[model samples]
Target: MSSTATHTDDDLMTVPDVLHVLRPLSKRTFYRWRETGKAPICIRLPNGELRIHRSDFKEWLDSHREQVAA
Candidate 1:
């Protein structure tokens, strides 16, 4: 990934931004995960838009990692 694609912990990701990285995943599925509390934590902006912090997104992804036996 290029520096431009890297996000800091404090960086806020919009739905489209996340979708870009999570391609092949539909917006409906993402929203469904959010509704079920399975997606990364997100904050609703004053305009009702959702944003997820980079750190939280990383944590969420990490939590779903599968362990393999050596």
Candidate 2:
């Protein structure tokens, strides 16, 4: 017998996963934003892992979109 598994959107990412997706931004830039208090707020799990919500990240990107009418 063969088995298959399905993955949900939430299952698609973790902090490092998100970082990998945003490759144009260096790791240093991510840390720098944290230090400067300019990064989108992250959530800290009970185990102390930091995570940025996918929705929040999308909102941040939308807000920074170019104003050009094209």
Give me the candidate number with maximum TM-score.
Answer: 1
- Report the C-alpha lDDT of model 2 over 38-68, residue by residue, as the tens digit: 7666777899777776677766667778998
List ranges where model 1 is wrong by over 4 Å.
1-6
Q: What TM-score fits each model?
A: 0.87, 0.65
TM-score of 1: 0.87
In model 1, which range of ten residues has the least summed lDDT?
1-10
- For all candidates in order, the CA lDDT equals 0.90, 0.70
